[model samples]
Target chain A: DVKVTQSSRYLVKRTGEKVFLECVQDMDHENMFWYRQDPGLGLRLIYFSYDVKMKEKGDIPEGYSVSREKKERFSLILESASTNQTSMYLCASWTSIRDEQFFGPGTRLTVL
Target chain B: SQQGEEDPQALSIQEGENATMNCSYKTSINNLQWYRQNSGRGLVHLILIRSNEREKHSGRLRVTLDTSKKSSSLLITASRAADTASYFCATEIGSARQLTFGSGTQLTVLP
Candidate 1:
């Protein structure tokens, strides 16, 4: 089974604070993605990495960044957490040969 | 802008009933996929239907794709309370290798 694990299930941060959400996939997939889910907006990608050291911006990359130093781990960085930035963050990984994306159990961040 | 949009943002049904959700996308796609998510958890891949394929089935889940209309539908047969969850449709474009997801349909199955 493919397993994707996120560093936190819930997080609380003050405005202007930097936040880091970590994700690791055991399947060794080549592609890793970070997305945020809002009530009515659904899940929108913030950033994605096709391979280690290679990253691409997704639809909503503002106020967020990603790092993939190794193939199995991908991290999402919030430069400055704001109240509007509070939401459920999800991480996913997929292999080059397959289209299925396995997702980690999300991280719910609350900016206070 | 979101590439796909699912209809009937919310659906409620009784146990043992059939539930269907529709998804429409704005562009040509290599394939369309359906995923299920329980509240506050990760999304689970349900099924995938290629552009060329009109219909596909997995256990109680059935998916249909129409390349001409750029639309797809997922039907869950004999739904149970355990089937209550949010369903999303994802579209894969050429070479992007990334899936674009719609907001999702919230399903409620009552016993």
Candidate 2:
């Protein structure tokens, strides 16, 4: 069984504050992704990393950044948090040969 | 920016009834996948159907992919109250390994 764990389950931050969301996967998957889910928008990709220190911008990557310091860890960073940045963030990892993805329990961030 | 579109944005069915959901994509895909998410939780993998395959089943969930039509369908038989969740269909383009997801269908299985 694959396990993806997020650093925080729920977080609240004031406007203009810096925030970081961490994710780690037990499985040695080669691909990792970050997404923000909204009510009507479904899941919008924020960023993704296929290898260490490598990253690509997804559909909605303007207000966020990501870091892949290690194969098992991926971190999402908000340069300066705003109220509109509040969302449920999810991290997922998948192997090169497999089509299935393992997702971590999401982090619900509330930017006040 | 959405690649896949799911029909019937919402569905309501009684327990033990079968529920079917449809998804259509714009571009050619290597594979199609179905995922389920309970309220306020992370998405879980359900099934995956490759381009060459038409239909596949896992437990009570049946998935069919029609490459010619660029569409797919998922059927859940004998749904239970625990089946009340949002179902989404995703498409993986040639070698990207990234999935483009559609707006999910909200399913409510009344018990």
Candidate 3:
């Protein structure tokens, strides 16, 4: 079974504070993704990495960044957390771009 | 990821009945995929259908794609209470690596 683990299930952060959400996948997948799920916005891609040190901006890359120093772990970083950025953050991994993505449980972040 | 739209934002049905949801995209896609997410949880991939293919099935789930119309539908037959979840349709365009997802259809299968 493919297992994806997130650093936190729920987190609270103050405005202007930096936040780091970590994801680790047991499967050696080549592609890792970060998405934020909102009520009506669906799952908007924040960033994705296809290989180590390789990253691409997705539809909503603003106010956030990502790092993938290794194949199994990916991280989403908020430079300065804001209230508007509060949402459910998810991390996923896939062996290939065309393959199914396995996701972590998700981290619900609240920015005050 | 090509931004796709799913209709009937919410659906309610009894167990043993079928639940159908539709999706439409604006751009050419290499494939269309469906995923299910339980409340407050991450998504699980349900199925995928290539643009060239018209239909596919897996277990109790059936998927149909119409490339000409840039649309797709997912039908969950004989659904059980455990099948209650939100269903999302996502489209992946050729040469693109990310998936653009629809808001999703909230499915509630009652006992």
Candidate 4:
């Protein structure tokens, strides 16, 4: 079984604080994705990396940035946390051969 | 932009009854996939249906796709309490490696 793990399951931060969310996948998948899920909005892609040091913006990448320094690790950075950024963040890793993504448990972020 | 939109934002069904959810999309797609998310958890991939395939089945879940209509349906036979979760429809467009997801349908299975 492919296991994807996030650095934190729950995180709380104040407005203007910098936040970092990390994800690691054991399968060494080539593709990793970051998404923020909100009520009524579902999951909106923030950023995705197909390989280390390569990133592409998704539909909603305004308040977020991503880093894939290593193949097994992907990180999401919030330049400055805001109340509006409070939502569930999910990380997923995928390989073309499987045609499916394996997701981490998710990080529920709360910005005060 | 969201590629898929699921109908019936919420559904409540009793165990042993069938629960059906529908998804509609705009534009052309290479494939459509379904996912299930438990409360406060990451989503789990349920099934995937390609543009060339109309129907596919896995265990108790049956998925059907109609490219002409750009719509799909997921039917879960004999619902169980454990099956209660939010279901989402995702579309893979063109050669994009990422998928666009729908808002999702919240299904509650009552015992």
Query: CA shift at A39, candidate 3, in angstroms?
Result: 0.1
The sequence of per-residue lDDT tens digits that candidate 1 reaches over residues A1-112 is 9999999999999999999999999998999999999987889999999999999999999999888899999999999999999999999999987779999999999999
lDDT of 2 at A70: 96
RMSD of each: 0.6, 0.8, 1.3, 0.6
| lDDT tens readout by residue for model 3, A10-97 | 9999999999999999988999999999998799999999899999998889999999999999999999999999999999998863
Candidate 1 lDDT score at position A31:
94
**Any runs in candidate 4 off by more than 4 Å, and if so which?**
none
Per-residue lDDT tens digits for candidate 4, residues A1-112, read 9999999999999999999999999997999999999999999999999999999999989989899999999999999999999999999999988888889999999999
Measured with C-alpha atoms, the lDDT of residue A51 in candidate 3 is 93
* Candidate 2 lDDT, B16-104, residue by residue in tens: 99999999999999999999999988999999999999999999999999999999999999999999999999999987889999999
In what order do the candidates fall by TM-score, top score first? 4, 1, 2, 3
State the DockQ, from 0 to 1, for candidate 1.
0.87
Worst 10 residues of 1 chain A by lDDT: A92-101
* lDDT, model 1, position B65: 94
Alpha-carbon shift of residue A2 in model 4 (angstroms)? 0.7
Q: What is the DockQ of each candidate?
A: 0.87, 0.83, 0.73, 0.87
Q: Tens digit of lDDT per residue, candidate 3, span B1-111?
A: 437989889999999999999999998898899999999999999999988899999999999999999999999999999999999998888777668899999999999
**True-structure RMSD for candidate 2:** 0.8
